[model samples]
Structure formats: C-alpha cells, structure tokens
Target: MSVITQPTDLLRQQDPQMADVLAGERQRQGSTLQLIAAENFTSGAVLAALGSALANKYAEGYPGARHHGGCEYADLAERMAVERATALFGAEHANVQPHSGSSAVLAAYAALLRPGDTVLAMGLPFGGHLTHGSPANFSGRWFDFVGYGVDAATGLIDYRQVQELAHAHRPKAIVCGSISYPRHPEYSAFREIADEVGAYLIADAAHPIGLVAGGAAPSPVPYADIVCATTHKVLRGPRGGMILCGSEFAERVDRAVFPFTQGGAQMHTIAAKAVAFGEAATPAFATYAHRVVANARTLAEALEERGFAITTGGTDTHLITADPAPLGLDGPTARGMLAAAGIVLDTCALPYGDGRGIRLGTAAVTTQGMGEAQMAEIAGLFAGALRGDAAKTRTDVAELTREFPPYGA
Candidate 1:
C-alpha cells in the first residue's frame, strides 16, 4: 500500500468500524456529483495539514499570547494563517480562528453592535443566511433586525428599498450577503447606504470570498467595515471561518473572535487554511476560479434551455439557483429525483416565485476538470432525472464521474 491508503489501513487495524464508514464516505463522494453551492474538494496538501499532529495540541488565545505552554509551533501556524489570509484578500488584518461561517458572523456582530441594536439585512425568506436575522438564531433574538427583499420582478437586490429601510430604521449596521442570490452584491451601493444612515457595513461574504481571492468577483474588503467569510466554498480551502478588516477594527474583531465568542483555536484547521490561502494565491488558482464562473454560466444557460427558471436570469459566480417548476417539480422533489440519479445539490428559496428552487455550483465539477461540454451533458442528465428515469440517469452519471474522478486512480 502507498502513503495515500496507509492511513485507512492503520485505522482499519485499530478501529475497523470507523474505518469502514470513512471508506464508504470516500466512495460515495467519488461516485456522486457534488453540486452543493457551499462545497468543494480541498487539495491533498490542505488535507495533509488537517491531519497533522497539531490536531492534538491545545492552544488558547492568539499567537505569542497563548495562555498555555508549549505553543511555539501553534503560534507559528496561526501567524502563517493570518498572514496568508490578509495577503490573499488584500485586507489590513485577518482572523482565521472562527470555527465556521456563522461563528465569523457572530464575531462581526459582537465587535460592531450591542444587543438590541437595530440591524438591516436581507430577509430570511429572500435568501439570507440564518445569522442574518432568522428568529431562531442568536442574531435575531439579541438584535432588532429589519429585513430587506429582492425586486419581485427581477429577483435582484432591491437597493432602493434597502436605502429607504436604512434611512427609516437608522440601523447600527447593515449586512449585505445571501445564501441563494446568484449575483454579486454592489458593495459601493451598500457602502453609500450605510454611510447615509451612519451605520457600519458588515459584509457576510461567506459565498463570494473564494471568487474574490481568485479575482473572479468584486471584493468587499474595501467598502465594508468588517468582512466575514468561510475558507471553503469556492476558495477550495478547509472548512473554517475567517474575518478581515481594516487596521482600525482589527483588534476589536480579533478580541470578539477569541474571548467573546470562541475559545481555543483549532491549530490543525488553521494550518490547513494557511495552506489553502497559499494555494489560492497562485496563477493556477486564478485560472481555476475564472473557469468556475464560466462553467456556472454554461450550466445555468443549459438548464434554462431545459425549461428551468434561472434566477436573476443567470449567475455571475459559481452558484446558480433555479426554479424547476416548469418541469412540474418543486425544489425538494427535484432534489430527490436528482439524488436518485446520483446527483447532489441543495434546495433554496425563490425570491420571485411561489415555491423553493434548487441551488448548485460549478466549483467541485470544475475542480474535477469538467468543462462546458460536460456541463451541457449534466443539464441533460438533470432533465432525464426529473422525468423519473433514475436507472439510466444514474448509470450515465456514474460513467461521467468515472471519466473525471475527483482524485486520480
């Protein structure tokens, strides 16, 4: 056996049960299409970092100020992550400690607003994340959140309404980001509105941060007071959260992430994030990022041609949210049919329609070396799957996946 398979072999020797489950998951991932909008496969180097010995270490607080002893290596890992993150996103300061995207958003709110303060964010039903203002979330329970919606006709952000809300509510902060909206948010317009209302601009860039790193999308670092993002998604990093800000807000953001919201930093994940940040800065990553967008546009167009209602008419990034109502399938039904055909994706709210829609992205498929031709074929597969042709569609999907295995044979 080679180094790649040695770990599984060792695990099987000691813990056969977990080893089997892990092996099954690996098989499932390679066999099925990973079209989830928030998912991507990280490089082997990043995975190696995650499995490093740092996972056993317990390092609390920031680098050089750790509350525990024997943290010299931990400090080095965290410093590398912070430096790489700042350079990749062109931010003055970066915090790579938040456990997930929601944690990052929590830190941003903690640093900027007090409990019960007014905040303006996209409404939950209009594709906003739970951290934005879902009543069940800490954000909505703690703060007074005013929700914004998209233009009913265009399925686009209603900037005019946002401005009016900002002026009327006098919110302490304004959040500009979403889970299903496919277009880039106009950061400048958001800045103008926040400035007009004397509110801080907090950009929850969990989705587009990867494209920003690859130069495929506009960055919010310049316009927002604080930016919260996930390290994965289109960024192709490990699962982790990151916060970027100007030097003025750096300390507050860091403190909020450290003592206020979270405790010890996961040194292994931080190391993995550093490796991912380094990878994302390369020329190849930029090409990959742009290709992700190209593939998404192609897929969106192909799906539209197949009778699905493409949201916002199309996509500007890796994500595409489309209503499958034309095919007599709602989002959940479409998702079930796709799963039967070995295709995987998520269901999301349709801003301009009556029911839910399916949300997917090209990041993983593009990473697997798929191109425009493959995207068109996938659309055909989607149509066939929704028509209840599960066996044939699953067989074709397996054949296509075999040609472009996520990891080489």
Candidate 2:
C-alpha cells in the first residue's frame, strides 16, 4: 500500500466528486473579483495551519484546565492564539474560542445581560448586521433590542438620538459598530452614553478588525467594555470568532465561551488565527489597511462621477453603499446584473425604506494587490454592467482579474 502524504491527492483518488467541487471553487475564486464587505483571502501560511494535524485534538476546556488529557500541543496552540490576539488588539484578555461572530455576540450577551434585559443596537436594515438586532436572529429573540438608524438627510448616525434612546431605555448594554455603515463608529461618544446609563458597551469590530489592528482605524478597546469580532473578515484568518475585554470581565467571558456557548474549540482555526494576528502586527499590514481605505474612496468617487448616488457622499472605510435606482435598478436586480458580469457584492435595503442599495468593499480587492487605478477600473465595470453592456464589461472584468489574480495565483 502507498502512503497518502498529500491530502489533495488522497482526496482525488478516494473521493473525486468532492475534489472536483473544491477545484471548481478555486477556479471561481481566481476568475472573479470578491467585493463582499465581510470576505477576504487568508494567506497560504494561515491555510496550512488551518489544515494541520491539530484538528484531531479535543481540548474541551481552557488551556491549563482541560477536561481531557494529551493536550500539551493543543494547550500551546491556544495559549499562543490568546497571547497574539491580546497583543494585537491591546486587550487585557482575549478568548479565541467562539465558533463565529454570532457565537461571540451571544457569549458576550450571556456574560453581561440577563435574557430579558434591554439592549440597544443598530437596526438591521440600516448598515447593521443581523446579529446586531434582527428579529430573526437569536440576539433579538432573547433580549429586548431597541434599534437606532442613521439620519435620513446626512446618512450619518445621530448621536443625540442614540443618547436619548439610551436615557429612556437605560439598556443593560449598548452595542456599537456596523456591517455596512461605511463610517467608523464614535466609540468615545458611545462610551459616554453607556457611562451615563450605567450600561456595558460592546463593539462588534468584525468588519474592521484588520484596520484597527493595523492602526489605520481607531481602536475600540479603550471605549468598549467588551469587543467581539470575526477573525475571517478583515483579519484574514480562518473562519472563527474572538472576544476581547478588560481583566474585570475576563473570567466571565471565558466561562461564557467554554461549556456555555461552544464545546471543544477548533484548535486548527485557532492556530491559523495566531498566524494571522502575527501578520497583522507588522508594519506592512498598516500600509495595506490604509491602502484599503484609499482604494474605497477612489472607487466611490469614480462611481459618483458616473452619475451614481453614493451614500454619505463617499466612504471613510473599506466599504461603499450606493443607491442603484439611478441606474433604473433595485438592489437585487443590480446584484444579479453584476454577478452575471463576474463582479460580486451584496444587495441591501435602503436605510429609509426606499427601493434598495448595493454594497461594495475594497478589502478583498486590495488583498489581491489592487490599488486606486484598479478601483477606478472596477467602478467603470460596474457602470458598464448596469448600463446593459454586461458582455463587454464581463470581458473587461476577466482581463482585469487575470492581471490581479486571487492570492497572486
């Protein structure tokens, strides 16, 4: 019998059907541009760690106090992940165990508030994530979540309204950060409101953790009592979640994560996260984070020049939300048209309940080594695709993708 050293080769020989699907996915990613605000490409090193032999372990508890034995290596991996995460975000403590962003949010709520307690967060339709307060999600099902939205005219958060709501409700927690708002949160302002109401402040930095870690955006650790983030998004790690908090709430957070929310942690993903955090702490990542924002600004400006309506006039982060009605299209229609043309993004409901809006991000493109010039070109493709010239636009998209291949091919 031959030794199956390479997993891919073994899969090809034993399960050709699944292998084909994986190959197809690789081709698709390489051929198309990924503009999803919550998506990015992890480095090859991160991928290697994710597929390491650590996946076979079963470390059920914290590093030192495990439920099972034979966990020395698992303990090392978890400790390294925690240390790197705390160092990267400047947190007093960090938990890299929750399975996803939703789990992290749930654990935070469980540790901080009672099931029926009132919590304040952004509305789902107004650039906020489903996990924030959507009725369909677990967060809204358990807690009384009052939502706030951006101002209609300025398309910005109304700090006065947030403060007023906090005063009236006196919520147990106030959640900041958004998935599609395009502007950074005023953590200091939220902290002040939380202080006045005697509420804990939770900042969900899932979308901008890389920017925050790289020093391109303001850190929320100073203002937020607890911060929850997904490691996969801008952090460019394996798909996992993390919780960062001060020493006061560290034990509560750890208990909430283990035995309460998740069972044994995904050690392989934690290993990958450790690698990613190390990469994010470097000076090169700071440059990439700044470039991500610069590219987004260029893309927004280029789209505006083409008669598109950009929310808030432009962007301050790596994302841009645009009203597609100018092109005689709704959000879903625009999304479909762009998908057919090989450009990928998301369709979102407009804040004021108008028609719909389309969201684009620069993180994945920037990771692929795209710059301002590429952003301009991508905007032109969007215009052409929405203007009933998808064929030509698709050709141009293919050409451009070839120039900036995913993960450098």
Candidate 3:
C-alpha cells in the first residue's frame, strides 16, 4: 500500500486548507524526533475514527440507558469500547468516559473517598502526578494527602517508608504508581499495606498500561481496587482516559463519573478509543511495547557512556532520567537546545530536590520506526548538543528524522 493513501489525497483535492494543516504536521514529524516521555503518536486509523461522522451525534448515557433518543448506533460503539477495554485489562468493568488520565483519577477518588478523608500518596516531586496529592489540585483540597518519597541516595521508593506512612496516616486510600519512577512498585506489597491500614489501593498505571497489557510488565488489576490510566501513552491511542475496577465497585465508579463529574461523553473520542483498543489487542502491540523498553535501556546506556548519571542507575520501562550536570547543562537548558534541534523532550526534577535531569522516552521515536541504531544516533545528537555542539546536533537530528519519518510516512 502507498504511504499517501486516500485520506491524504482526498484532503489535497477537496480541502486544500485542511490539507495544509496535515502537510505541515507531516513536515514537522519528518524533521524532528520526539523523545517526550509521556507522548506518543496515534495511528492514522485512530485519527480517522476521531474525526468521523460519530462526532455529529450526542449520546448522554451508557448503552440501554440514556437521557436522550437516537442513540442505538452510539450505544453499540460504546458497548464495544467498554467490552474491549475490560478484556484487554482483565477487569470486571471499565469506564471509557473520563476525559483524561487526571479526570479518571478524580472519578476514582470521588467514588472511593469522601472529602476530608486522610490519604497516602507518593510525593509529586518524587514521580507522582499532580492529581495524586498536589496542594493546588482537588485531590489535596478534598483530602489530607500525606506523601512518601524515594530514598534520596538510591532514587527509589522506600517500601518500608510507605508502609510506615500508611500506618501513621490511616488513609482512606493509598495511591500507588508514578509518572517518572523507573523501577516497578510492588503492587501486592501496596495492597498488603492498604489492607493492614484498612485503605483502598488505587493503582494509577497511566504510564505503564501498555507494558502491563503486553505482559512485559506486571498487572495491578488483580490487586488494585481501582485502576486509572490514559489511553494515549504507551497504549498508542487517542487522548482519552479509562477507569477499570472489579464488580464490587462498579456501581459507585459509574455514578461518580456520571452524576458527580462530567456531562455528555465525547462519542467521537470514544470511537477513536475503541479503534485504539482494537489495535492494542494485537500481537504487534506486544512487540512495540517490548521495543519501547529496550530502546529506553539502550538510550540510557548510551547517555551513561557519555558520563550522564541515570536515575535509579537505569530504567526498567519506557522512560529514563539523566542528570545534565556532567554535560554542562541543566534541565531547562537541555530542553530548550533539544527543541531547537527538533528533538522534543521534557525537563523534570528528580525524586529529591531540584535535581537537574532531562527525562527521555522511546515511544515517540519507536512510533517513528527508529530502533536501537537510530536511538544511538539521536542520543549522540543530544550528547553533542548538550556539550556545546548545537550546530552539529541540529543538522544531524534533521537528517536522521527526515530518513525515518514517524508513522512510516
């Protein structure tokens, strides 16, 4: 099949203005390699579904239960999505309604926790998301969130410390998962701690859902009372979120999402999510997930070879954190220089203080079809750019990205 298929052709002929938008996007992707740890490119099929005719309709409730009429087709689509998601994650019920990962977290919290209840969560600066317990977020406003952090010296979560916090706080829920940590959390350990303290275990697997689904990483479905995740990250889906839980909590979860938060669901995005779920169920997604981890490790090794200090000594998943101090750069500077060179990535603080580190991942590059060999090339560009060779880095990134355009375009 040709790379420029019917969609590209139809847009070029019927809608030149919209065609220009896509062309510009294609040009950008062809000239830059993205390394942002939380970002990934969805398939063209997913995009097609997102922009499909389903967007024209309004569906106010779940299948066989709606506040409005003319929803038979919408009901079918929603049911397919719900069933596929539950099967994929091995959960008893799934809600594909939350707008984003954070929204899903809010729904779970609202369902399982009451305001002013004490909660235990990982510290935000230590790999936890803002929704977990950040003061400015609703999670913090509604609950007293006591946090645990990674050991300062080891850069890893201290399980004993978490257990101690749970015992001390007597939390209503113990949130487990991270946006930046490398090593896997002991979910069963967390469950044990939660049980001992009479707290519910909520696993925020937004970063590792794809890995878990592929069996390359462990699943928390069996132990966690509720699981929340973004469908876009490693799942390679449209930008949406999901809430998965066992039958025991299904009613409360649904009620929280419908009556407590949000109005009509975005049926178009749901359709796109359904397509993404189908794509993720394939054996190819397993291969893709495994390669993402492999690529991260390779990139980490390459950076360490050049004297950068990797967080936790290495990565066991799709992301890696490296101190830019050795390269004469800080997180902000490294991010700016890399973006100018068309290599997009984020600058993040380490588990402790304002530790200088640039967080990188393999999903975007792997989506662009670059394996370990190309990762080595991109890492070299980063090393050069950070070490006072910006000109060479820009030139090299443009060349390498042009050769391996994302989506295989």
Candidate 4:
C-alpha cells in the first residue's frame, strides 16, 4: 500500500500545500463511507500504471500508427489496453482512448448517426446519463432524441412501450443503460426491438462492465452493435472510457473516437485499464463481483424494513435506489443528513414521482472486504443518520470505517 502514500510523501517535500489536500482526501475516504454507485477503489498495481512513464506521452492515433514521434511506449500501452479489453469483454475491437464515459457515448453517436438522426434512450428522469440527450450536451443539440421510461408502478423498463415508440419514430439507434436503475438491462429484448425497427443497438454498460468482465453479469457484447463503458466504477481502474464493437463497425468506431471526437490518447489511464482488465479476469475478482450484488440486495431489504421504499423491490446489481419519504424526509434532506453523519452517496430521480431518491452501491465496501452482514449495518447507519442525532451517527460511521480501511486494515 506504499502506492497510496509514496506520491504524497514526495509532494510533501516540494509542495506541502497540495500534499495537505491529498492527505485530507485520503483521511476523508478512510474515515467516511463511499456509497456512490459510480465509484470504487482501484488496485495499487493500477495506480502505479497511472503514474508510470506513459503519462508523459502524446500518442495521437491507434497502435502501429501515430501522429507524433517517440510514441513507442505509448503505442505499447494502448495495444495492451485494446487487447485486454477485447479479450475481457469478448469484443472484436476496443478503443480505449476516450477521456470519459460521456466521451465514449459521443463517439458511438459519431460512428453511427448523422445530425438530425433520431435516437431513442432512457429518459434522464429515470436514471439515464446526460449523454443520452440532455439539452445541455452535444447529443441533444445535434440529434433528434426521443426518450423512453420505466413503468411507474414496477420501476422497470416498459419494453412494449419502447417497441411502440421505436416503430413510431424509427430512430437510427437505441441506447440501453442507466445511472441508477439497480437491475440488469434486458439486452436481448433491446436487440430485438432495435432489429424490428432497423436501428443500431448501443449498450452503455459503464456501471456493469466490471461485473461483465468478472462473469457476474450478462454480456452486452453479444447483443449490441456498439458497447460503451468507463474504465472506473466497479471496474476499478483509472478514470477513462472505451468503446467495443464487432469488426464490422470497428474502423468507423476507431475513426470516430480519434480525429472525429477526441485528441491524443490518455496513455497512462489506458495502461491502468490494461492492469484492471487483467485483474478482473482472475478468480478473486469474480468472487468480489458476485459479493457486490449480494451486499446490495441485503442492504436494499434492510433499508425497506427501516421505512425506505426500495426501488424495483431490490437489486440484481451493485446499485440500489430508494425513497426516504417514508421516513418523513425528501432525497435532498436525507442526503444532507447522511452527509452530516459521514455516509457519502448521491440523489437520483424517482420513477414514480417528481421527487428525487437516494442512490447507493456496494462496490467500494465490498472492496474493503465487507459482506452481507456489514451491508445490514450500513442500512442501520442510514436510518440513524436520517432520524437520530448527527454527531452520534457520525461517530458510529467513523467507528465502522476504522474497522475496514480502504487501503488496508
């Protein structure tokens, strides 16, 4: 775990002020909880790769070809990242150079659609990412977007309604993924709908790509024409994005990610992604992935017992979304209370109402070696944080986190 401290140690000599900030962040992570659905701790090996020599490179193209000289090491890193990603996800090709998940989605759009081409995606109110056509992003400005949503009663995708919309609008592409849905997407159903309407199926598997790599979740590679994901989240790599597809769209995808959308590759993050893909292929990561789901399910049930309305009844993935209104609190008020009590998480749009709900995940806690029992403990903490004295709840959270340090015990 020297990987966690060595950089800070060196920075403390030349730049004590910035060193103090890093130290504060480290202490905050160690002393509090991380329930955010889109966050996780990267392994030390991955961190080392991120800080390696490749960070200085400026490679601007795919392997065996570049727009800059002295890209020998940079090309090597990208090739390894591409190969490992293709193997890990069972795709024919991978572009690991997009700076973030949103960028990957942009490249996917660039590869397949023209300006004004209609696109169908989950509505932002029901857990969709902003790239799915938020008015604030490029996708909304350039393309005509139609939104689909979950059933208000069941809190799940309404496939029949999606089919009706797809046929009516005949969009050029359909996107399947969400930021806080808490369940596995039916990729086969999406593929069927897309095929019936002559639309390309795009799977934004950012949140579940790690589970897919570990064999804990179904693969979207076999079903979607294009798959977009992040190298972080449950994948536990440095923050970056990648695109996967069959060879048929491989060239178009690569070109879109390079000159059309992004600049030089982030060689360091790509190297770190290679390390994570290697780790995820191991037996240990598979166990960890399944345990993430187990902890999420247990936490969801426990929260329901304590007066939160669990979305979709429970979770089949690491994510869980719940309403705190049953406890006489709204999402923002509940979040402020939890933050005061040192339990970190995010607020999400609810399926049934105009109000927001709390969203959480078990990846970080599972990485800290917690299990189902600890998940129940966390739910108890949530209740106390929302309904009891803030100082007492904060103390209990600190005590619990001390028992399981993120880097080590």
Candidate 5:
C-alpha cells in the first residue's frame, strides 16, 4: 500500500465538509433509537483502541513472529486478545484475524472442506444467513450444499429431516446457528447428526456469543468443531470477526485465515477486540447480556399481544422476528416505516411465514441505558407505526430516545 504522509493535510484541504458530516452522524447515533439486530454501541475505550497508533503497524503473522518488521507492540496486543478470547469462550484455539463474520466463515470452510465438497446448512428464508450457503454467495457457488429447514407447524429445526438429509448427502460439514431465527439452536442435535454422518460441526455464533460468554445462553464451543462469530453483534465490540476451533485444527485454521483468506491482521482491530474481551469478563457485560434477552422477550411478547405474528413464537436471544403481512406490510415497507418513525428495525423473511417480518433487537438501546420500561414504550411505537399512525409513533420514539440519552462520547 502507498503511504500517505499528509493524510491530515489532505482531509483538511479536500474534505472539510466531510468532517462536518461525520459529526452530524455522531449526533444521529446519539439522538436516534437503534433497534437494528446486527448493530450495537461499543465502548468509548473500544473505539479509541480501533483508532489507536496500532493501526499504523503491518504485522503479517501471529504474535511473537511476523513477515514484516516492528511487531513488538503488536505482539503484546495480539497475545492479550488471543488469551482473553480463549478464556472467555473456552476454546482450544482462536484466530482474531478475519475482518468480518463472513470472512470468518470463509476461513473455517477453507480449513475444513475442499471446494465443491458437500455441506449442509440452514436455508435463508427460514432464519439462515447468506454466508451459510445462499446461492448468491461464494459458499453456495463453490460447494454442493443441502439445506434443512424449520418445521412448518413448530417453527423450529426438524432434526429428523436434518438427519435424513445428512445420511443422504453425506456432507463434510453441518453448519448451525442463524441471523434471525428466534429460538435457541439445538446444538446437541446438530452434533449428533454430524457425528452420525462423520462430518464436522460448525456453529456461527455471531449473534449469541455474548449470551454464551455471559452464561445466559448455551455454549457451542463444547460441541462445535469450529465456532465463528462477529465482534460487533451481541459481543458489542468493534466491527470484526473471529474463528475459534478445537486444538486439532488450530494450525489449519490459522493458515486458512492468513495465507488463504486474509493478508495481514488489522492490529488496531485486534486491540479493540482485546478491549471487548476484557469488557466481557466484567459483571457489567453479563448484566447487559441478561438485560438484552429480557428486553427482547418483553418486546416480542408485547408485539404478539398487539396482534403481530412473532416468528418461532418468541425469542431466546437478542432479536425478535415478526411477520407484518397481516397488517399489509412487507419486510421492506415495514423497515422503511420504522426507520421513518425513528424506531429503526431491519427487514427479514421468517423461516416459514408467507410475508416479511421486521427484525429488531435491544442491544443498542440497552447500551444507551434503557431498561424494560423503555423497551415497552418502544414496542408501543412499533405497534403504532405498523397501524399506520407513524407520525405519533415517531414523536413517541423521539421522546423516549431523549429520556435515554446516548452513551456520551
């Protein structure tokens, strides 16, 4: 990469107005109600680490060794992150290099399976993510993938079907976990199916890592051969990803992340990861995790009581997925309406529902110090907006947002 010796001069000369835009964005983050399931508010300390001096370094290898020079500080920062991550998740090995959850999954696939190998994953409309073998992504194009789905009656995974598919296809890996599925995944069932078929088990705990770490949710580390996650979501860290695996695949996973997928680890991101890991070790993080779940359940229940159909009946994690078709709303329309009303949710398709549902979470609001009371009010705003009186809903949300001011920078 070419060096920019006068980045400050360039910014000051060419994009002074852009600087003002950034400040306005910060003001929005502070003033708005953020219900996006995949987003969270990181600590000021974590943000500082992400913008620290460590970003200037170019360390091409793991701690203690590098392909480039000047890794003394990088070694310390990376080692801290590695150690904390292992302790937090009880994993045998951890790779903090992948830039996002998608990259982490790619690295795991690279380490465990060959291109064109058969893989079994959850279907997208049924609460699965695109990276989990959607046709538009590389995972689908390069691999022969068979999918399993939730039971139409129960809205939960049907393990018998998964078993039958595994026996028929003989996949090399079985991927569990999801982006919008509300109920907890039956990891043990997935493990049994993988074992029956002699396949590796990979758990994409991108949305539930914080719950697992906080002991509020089940740990996939004990059952999964590899666990991939994003630092951003429920982890409430900077926007990055990680891959943790059994000791046997340590070298292979590292090689896949470094030589195969990514060039060099972003030292600044690793530093931020260390900060997040440290934060996760604290009691406050555990409380935050518990509150996130509590708020989600409360919101889901309130929405259901208001006549909206909640997917999977309710939520056991940070997100709530509900179909808005009964109210003449599609996913995109529901999302736009909520954003306009300042309630801020994303649109997603339910596993078996006929229409799109909005996916909302309590992480950001919880970070802003809103409790269950605030969650109830937010749920009211959602109901009002869905009922087509978004003006009043927007005013209500703005008021609630004012009460729970943003975590000051």
Candidate 6:
C-alpha cells in the first residue's frame, strides 16, 4: 500500500495557492457555527479515507463482480458500504454508488419510471428538492411532474391536497421528503396515496436519514418502495448518494446507477461512506440525533420569543424555516447578516409567494457538542444580528464556537 501524506503537506508542495484556500476554509469551519441543514463536518478518519489512494482505482461494478482488474480493495470498501447502509436503513438491498443525491434520484427514476411517466411531488418552493421534479431539472423535463404544496394557513403539508392531486394525476410515482420541511413527513400517508393511485412511493430521505437511523424520526424504509439519500447531511458522511430498496428492485436500481447514471464509482468516497455508516450505527449517534432535534426546538422557541415566526410553528427534526419578514429583513439580507456574524445558514423562499425565509439546522451545532443552552445563545445572537448588534453578536458567536470546536478540535 502507498503511504498517504497530509493534505496540507501535499497541497503545499504541489500548489501553495490551493493550500491557502484549504487552510482558510478549515479555519472558517473551525471558527463558525455551521447551521446549514445540508452541511456537516465529516470526521478526520473519513477525511483520511477520502484523500486515500483508493481514489486512483476505477471500480466499474458491484463487489465479487467487477469489469476491471485490481479491485480487491475497492470491492471490500463498496461491499462494506452496501452492507452497512442496508443494515442501517433496514432495507433488503442497498446500492452505494451514484455520485450525488441528484444522481441517486435520477437512477431511482430510471429504474422505476419510463419517459413521460407522471410523478407527483412536493413543489420546489414548498421545500422539495430540485430532483423532486423542479421544472428546470431533468426529472421535470423527462417526466410529467405534478406538484403539491403546504396548507396556506398552517404552512404544513396538505395531505388531503396530496391525495386529491394523486387521484387526479394518477402518477406513476409519488416522491416524498423535502429539503426545508421542519416536520416529519407523513410517509405512511404518502404510501397510502401512492397505493390509491397505483403509484410507486419514492422516499427522498436525503435530509433526515441520520434521524431515521438514530430513531429520532420514523423510518421510510418500511413504507416506501424505494428510498434515496445523500450520505452527507445529518448522516455526517462523505458527499455521495445511495439507494435502498427491496430485493425485487435491487438489480434494477443497481443497473440504473451503473450503466445508466455513472461509470466507475469513487472508491475513496465509498470507503469514507463505510466509515461514516459505522460511526452512525454506534449508540452515541443515537444521542446525537435526538439532541439535534432538541436543540432545533430550543432554537426555534428562542427565535419565536424574539418575534420571529417559525414556519409550521416549530420543528420536529433538525431543521427550522423561519419567516424573516417580521424582522424587517429579506432572506438574502438575513443570510448575509448572520453570515457576517460567523453564523452560517441558508435563505429559502417561503412555501407561498416570493417572500424569503431563513432555514436553520441543528445537526452541525449538535455535532460540535452544543446543547440546549448553546442553542439559546445562538438564537440570541441571531436576534442580535438582526437587531443591529452584529459586532457584539460576532464576538459572542466566536466565544461560543471556541467552546465547541468543529471536528472536536
């Protein structure tokens, strides 16, 4: 085996400019509160695996069945990822390839739906992802996509509307899950709707797979015909996607991922994913998952106390989407203001209209060992930033971040 050098050393030797960029990013992450719902600080062990020599290989097929030579180690890594994922999600089969969350969704679509097939999914502006049939994405261009939105008054998923749309569209597939939804998706209800319309249910658990595996949220594996997720997010894994399904659809999903979506899998990333899966299966991860939800609730309450309107009232998961209009700030302005204070988050459009909203998550902060008290402090800093005390809030944020260093220092 070839020896692997530290990223800083190797990059410094090859390109000093790129090395500076990496160092700057590392410092930024180490000093900031990462509240982005889709982001996390992967472990150092995962980073090592990601930067390993396994990246040099080109593994084109599943374990024990590869098209290329010299895949012994690659096969081991991929098999470990597949097994751990299957075990983690309690699925009959798991495909550990597919380069991204988008790729995974594409593969799932290809495996189940034909061209021009109708798919009923949540509207993009209503918290659904682009791959969930946004008009600009391939999912929308290739297939007929009907969208459902939240109830206008409550800002919650209108299941009655979903069923009505399902019955009207008679879609071939019903996609569930969202990028910004604060409450747990009614997966069983979606399954029922899909059954009523003779449609396959695709659960895009990309944002909450860790919560599912940690038992903080309900698992969709038992209800949906196919489930897709990105290994990052709350899972705290490398950036990659996975597909989980029953035995009947295993082969179809795998083929769609391989010949249909991508070529050789990234062995290094797969190896890192296996590491993350192992970490997630531990008992400690369960506590972390629950704490993430707890912290989110605390933060939402804090924000609400300061006069911010949390969409859906509050959060049952790691994410919270707050209407920042009451704060006299638009989504972009709120994001910029908070970012300047070293509090990182994203801006999203509200479920209805063109108004902007602020989306916050507790996964990364909880991972950094922050608890409810810290969440309250963070929420205070958020209010301070919006209330024109950004400098003081920045200092407070720095102090808090110092107490809970990213990557555990």
Winner by TM-score between candidate 6 and candidate 4: 4
Judge candidate 6 against the unseen true structure and give its global Cα lDDT, from 0 to 1: 0.90
Better of 4 and 5 by lDDT: 4
Q: Which structure among the candidates has the greatest lDDT?
A: 1
Off by more than 4 A, model 1? 1-7
lDDT of 3 by residue, 198-250 (tens): 99999999998988877768999999999999999888888989999999999
Model 4: which residue pairs collide?
Answer: none
TM-score of each: 0.98, 0.97, 0.95, 0.98, 0.95, 0.97
Candidate 1, residues 211-308, lDDT tens digits: the string is 99999999999999999999999999899999999999999998999899999999999999999999999999999999999999999999999999
Native-referenced Cα lDDT, model 2: 0.88
> Considering summed lDDT, which 10 consecutive residues are worst modelled in model 1?
1-10
Instruction: Please identify which of the two predictions, 1 or 5, would achieve the higher TM-score against the true structure.
Output: 1
Q: Model 1 clash pairs?
A: none
- Runs in model 2 with CA error above 4 Å? 1-7
What is the lDDT, from 0 to 100, of the residue 249 in candidate 5? 94
Error of 5 at 407 (Å): 1.6
Q: Where does model 4 exceed 4 Å of error?
A: 1-3
CA lDDT, every model vs. true structure:
0.94, 0.88, 0.86, 0.91, 0.86, 0.90
Worst 10 residues of 2 by lDDT: 1-10
lDDT (tens digit, per residue) of candidate 5 on 292-336: 999999988888887778887988999898887777778888888
Q: In model 5, where do residues sit more than 4 Å from their true spots?
A: 1-14
